[model samples]
Target: MAGVTAMTVQLNRMDRVSPWGFRLQGGRDFRMALSVKKVEPRSPADGQLHSGDAILAIDGYDASQMTHAQAQQMIRNSGNTLQLTVNKGLFQSLKPTGPIKFSPAAAYGYSHGHSTF
Candidate 1:
């Protein structure tokens, strides 16, 4: 909590059927904390959340001590509009910088027009 900064984010179901357009990673294993791993471009969480932002709570429910599966389940049950309380700075040190390394085929696709960077 020392370096953490808490904030709330409200994400509405943009497509009405798709997932929240964000991926989460990390938990207690290997001493890792719960954090956002990715946010899809043009998605609801795209600009609202960032990779390495620690999930401190979900819909006002404490999430800092939750396991990956537990947190996933909570998100799944949050309905169309979800509220998330996150620690924006707590896990920023874990965020990756520069382009991510990919396999040759994937890299080619990304470099071309098949994927978004």
Candidate 2:
């Protein structure tokens, strides 16, 4: 932890509450996940898409009403080129790096691993 960068999220109560206080408004917004709390999936994506994807961008475009398809006809007529920036998987927790915690029996000389930021 010498000089690692950290990321954080700030939230407001209004974010959790419905805009109109209607029961239908909540489910219309997002999908819940362990890694990503309220993930946004593109419309015309009811049962196909899901949470936990990195979602860089869609076709180099933001998920706007025009870009995010609505009608089935729009989805069916989609272009073959799908440019996306996906995280691809869930975020995993890291283990602590304490001193001298190797189990020699299972060490096999290359026990530890490396990762780049």
- What is each predicted model's overall lDDT from 0 to 1? 0.70, 0.27
For model 2, the local distance difference test gives: 0.27
lDDT of 2 by residue, 1-117 (tens): 243322222111223222211001001112311122133333222222234333333444333222211211232233432233334334332345787666652465522221110
Q: What is the lDDT of candidate 1?
A: 0.70
Over 4 Å off in model 2, which ranges? 1-28, 31-51, 64-77, 91-117
What TM-score does candidate 2 get on C-alpha atoms? 0.25
After the best TM-score superposition of candidate 2, give how far the Cα of residue 13 lies from its true spot, in angstroms. Answer: 43
Which residue pairs in model 2 clash with each other?
Answer: 54-87, 56-85
Candidate 1 lDDT by residue in tens digits, 7-116: 99998885547768787776543256777777898887889988778878889988867766667777887778889998884664344468857656355552211111
Once model 1 is optimally superposed onto the true structure by TM-score, how far is the C-alpha of residue 51 displaced, in angstroms?
0.9
